[model samples]
Target chain A: MKYTEEHEWLRIDGDVVVVGITEHAAEQLGDVVFVELPEIEAVVAKGDEVCVIESVKAASDILAPVDGEIVEVNEALSDNPGLVNEDPQGDAWFFKMKLDDLRVLDDFMTEDEYKDFLG
Target chain B: MSEHSTELKQTPLHALHLELGAKMVPFAGYSMPVQYPMGVMAEHLHTRAHAGLFDVSHMGQVILTPKHDMAALEAGLEALMPVAVSGLAEGRQRYGMFTNAQGGILDDLMFANRGDHLFMVVNAACKAEDIAHMKAHLADVAQVQPVTDRALLALQGPQAETALAALVPDVRAMRFMDVLSVDTLFGALWISRSGYTGEDGFEISVPATTVVDFARLLLDRPEVAAIGLGARDSLRLEAGLCLYGHDIDTGTSPVQAGLVWGIQKSRRTGGAREGGFPGADCILAELADGPAQLRVGLHPQTRAPMREGTEIWDASEGGQKIGCVTSGGFGPSLGAPIAMGYVDSGHASTGTPLWGEVRGKRLPVTVCDLPFRPSTYKR
Candidate 1:
């Protein structure tokens, strides 16, 4: 798993990858009451808003860290959006996508590097 | 009260908020906690189910005592507010507002008749100005004293009475809008059976020096959790209560804002104090003829929350903007997006469908009965 400056984490599973907001992002967002994800088979460019996270306080846009084609979305979140806060990096992932450019992964930060950057 | 907000002021519970891991935000010139570790949703639900203690010390408190007689003091206050203050019984409180000459709201406040004097609490953002306005207007009739020595706390929820009863027994006997002076372990406490969350609750006004320790004593109970301003806003919004600057402002009149209920019968037409307060001509006229626009509950059909300043358009009138959303957010209690906005009187019906423009996208919304959640006040 790697993190981006936009507070999104990418979990690589061979050629397919899963994406979700980071724990720090979830904590900052309070409790997410709604999640708006891009439709499956949608192609998103780097820095494009692929998802929106809404809270009672405010709404935030979650952008794609790299260009990719979305394959699946976590359907469970639509009914129980609080799952993002409970386990943002695991089962509560936003969407899965096949990486269009492998070079974008090199730009992400490692777990230790992201921890240091957050501090 | 300083114009320069570069350095934020801290409340009496600032250190405790930091200890509780609260997310601090700048609000009304103070660095106050917006939410705690429980997050807004859990905190709001907990407040509805159990007790939630809130540090409301940032709100302004003022004590107005008569220099002559009680009636004179009441009349003095009546000159500034639209509510019937002279008739308010002892240990009773009524919601009122400071109206401008054009029938606009300067600020809405809660004024309690304390037998010997009056206790008024105004919004924090406009407190300084409110104090100034009152002092300048009533300097001859009463002594306007701003309460600087007290810290206020709101213990609100279904179990608030049970939690507060452990500290003060008199609280159990009080009903909604009832006020009392009771003694507790820390010091003398003035309690009011009132809160913004539409729950059965109490507002405790205690000495500033001992407030932190006193609040900590209450937090020791399992039924109580410290809630922040974030949940406070949502809870009140769910109850259809207006936020000072957002829902009601200087440009909005009490009648247009759905606050005509606050003005007593005696203050209305054919009553003793009819047409006496500021902007009474316009207010009374609007009361009789109905306001051109009305503040109404807006339910956006979609789950996406429409925020403040979102424009509302007439669905059948070729997208004509009839009003704007003043307060909108996802309601934890309702499990959907709820909002309150001022709309054209023709479009303010309970079932009238409208359109809310959010980020340039039109979202379906309907006018519904206020208080998306029914009030559970222990009246």
Candidate 2:
């Protein structure tokens, strides 16, 4: 598992990168009520805001972890947005993308590094 | 009192909220629960259908008395507010606003005449500033004391009276805007027939020492469920009630905000037209003709809700930026997207064509009257 400073986590599943919010971020956001995801096939750059997550209190933007072409966007969030709050790491995957350069993962923190960063 | 930094203040019911798995957030410099595990939409719908118990201890409660003469205290309060304080009957409440010299509202507040004493409740965010402002102006004639340790709980819904009647029987007979002293399981409390949400409800003021016991007694009822600030905002929005700093501010007048009814009829017609209240001329004139910019309700053409700060344009005038949305959200009761904003009087009528620019796209909208959902307050 690789994590960004913005609290997004990405897991490489063969050629597709599964992305979702981290537990720490979801806890701070409180109850996740709505999620707006990018369209499939849309090209986004690293650090670009590509998604929005709204809780009861406020809304926050989720940034792209790497320059990539979107392969799959999570449609379940439109109906069951609470999945993000219930399971931020597992069933709440936001989108999958094909990385333009696989080396971008080098800049992300590992699970151990993220635990220390949170402390 | 507990190291007044930027940290959110916790009420006595904080532990109870957390135990209910409420989603907590910072509001008015306090760590408050915005919703419980049920979520905002569900909580809002439930409150309208049943009863919702809300923790409103964050609001500032204060007592005012005469330092010199009793008449002087009433005159001082009346000078600062638009309400006719002198005419208010004992055990009655009145809604009023503090205005600036330009006729803009500084803060909307509730004042109650408690026999020889006056009681008030101000918004959480504006409490400190309001107290300071009142002290600076009325210190010579009146004494202002802040009751920061008190706890305020609101039981709101159609069945609130029924649930509360079991504890305080007379609470059910209290008329709207009336305050009554009732005895409860915990102790004596001041129960007022008023609430922020446009529903039949009561706000109970209890001592800080026994607030927890009082809360637990109400929670024991199966008809009551704990609600948070999230549902509170959505409920009030559906009722077309204004939230300070969003719907009205130090720059918006009562007339523009559709609160002209709060201005007493005697004050409008009597010799008090040129009275020494702040911005009397501007407010009285606006009352006579109408404000240049009027607050109106909006119904978006699509399901996408238009949020605050979304620019509004007139399609007939080259899409000119005429005004901006102040408060907007989905009204579960109305089953549509509703909003309120300031617009030019020419384009403020119902059915006026308007557009809300969101995400570089113009969403078709129409100007409508307020309270998109009819109010069910037991008036």
* lDDT tens per residue, model 2, A1-119: 99888999999999889999999998787666668789899999987889888665566889988889999988988677778988999999999999866777978899999999999
Interface RMSD, every prediction, one decimal place: 0.9, 3.3
Please give, for residues A1-119, the per-residue lDDT of candidate 1 as tens digits: 88998888998887888899898999888888888878999998988988888887898998888888999999998888889989999889999889866667878999998999899
Where is the poorest 10-residue window by lDDT in model 2 chain A? A27-36
Report the lDDT tens digits of candidate 1 across residue range B1-379: 3667588888888999999999999999988999998989999999999999999999999999999998998998898888899878999888999999999999999989999999999999999999999999998889999998899999999999999998888889898999998877778898999999988899999998889988997899999999999999999999999999999988899999999889889989999888778899999999999999999999998878888999999863466999999999988888899999999999999999999987677889999999888888778
Clashing pairs in 2: none
Q: After superposition, how far is residue A50 of candidate 2 from its true place, in Å?
A: 1.6
Q: Give the per-residue Cα lDDT of candidate 1 at B206.
A: 92
Those runs of model 1 whose alpha carbons end farther than 4 Å from true positions after fitting are B1-3, B316-318
Q: lDDT of model 1 at residue A72?
A: 93
Q: What are the per-model C-alpha RMSD values against the true structure?
A: 1.7, 3.5
Docking class of 2: acceptable
Docking class of 1: high
Individual DockQ of the candidates? Answer: 0.80, 0.25
Best by lDDT: 1
Q: All candidates' TM-scores?
A: 0.96, 0.87
